[model samples]
Target: MERDSQLELYQAVAVRLKEAHARVRSLQVPEGVRMALSRKLLAITAVAKHDLARAARRLDRLMKDLDEGRFPEGD
Candidate 1:
């Protein structure tokens, strides 16, 4: 991607990540589930530091799972 387009994608991913984190925080799920989801989100955030595109895709999958009411299994 061009520099300008990559910057836009990164910004959009950052915004989506913020929204996802907030949504996870607002969920009424059990603490274990919440922590599991939070860990997944944090992992994606770390991935974003090295691979923005992969992170975006991972975020999309996570948000989709959440939207479909698929909370992570407890540890």
Candidate 2:
């Protein structure tokens, strides 16, 4: 991808990341579960810094899991 398009994808990823964090924080799950979800989002954010496209795909799957109520089990 060109630099310009990569920049655009990064911007979109940032927005989605922010939304995902908020969604995870707002979840009614237990603290452990919330923390696990938050950790996954953080991992995605870190991945975004290196591979925006891969990060975006991971983020999309995370969002889908959240939407479908497929949360991680609490410890």
Top lDDT model = 1
Put down candidate 2 lDDT per residue, 3-60, tens digits, no spaces. Answer: 8998899899999999998888888889999999988998999998888899999999
Give the worst 10-residue stretch by lDDT in candidate 2: 66-75
Name the runs in model 1 displaced over 4 angstroms.
none
The local distance difference test score of each candidate is 0.95, 0.92
Give lDDT tens digits, candidate 1, residues 30-55: 99999999999999999999999999
Cα RMSD, model 2: 1.1
Count clashing residue pairs in model 2: 0
lDDT of 2 at 13: 95
lDDT (Cα, 0-100) at 58 in candidate 1: 98
Estimate TM-scores for all models: 0.95, 0.95
CA error at residue 22 for candidate 2, angstroms: 0.7
Residue 33 CA displacement from its true place in model 1, Å: 0.4
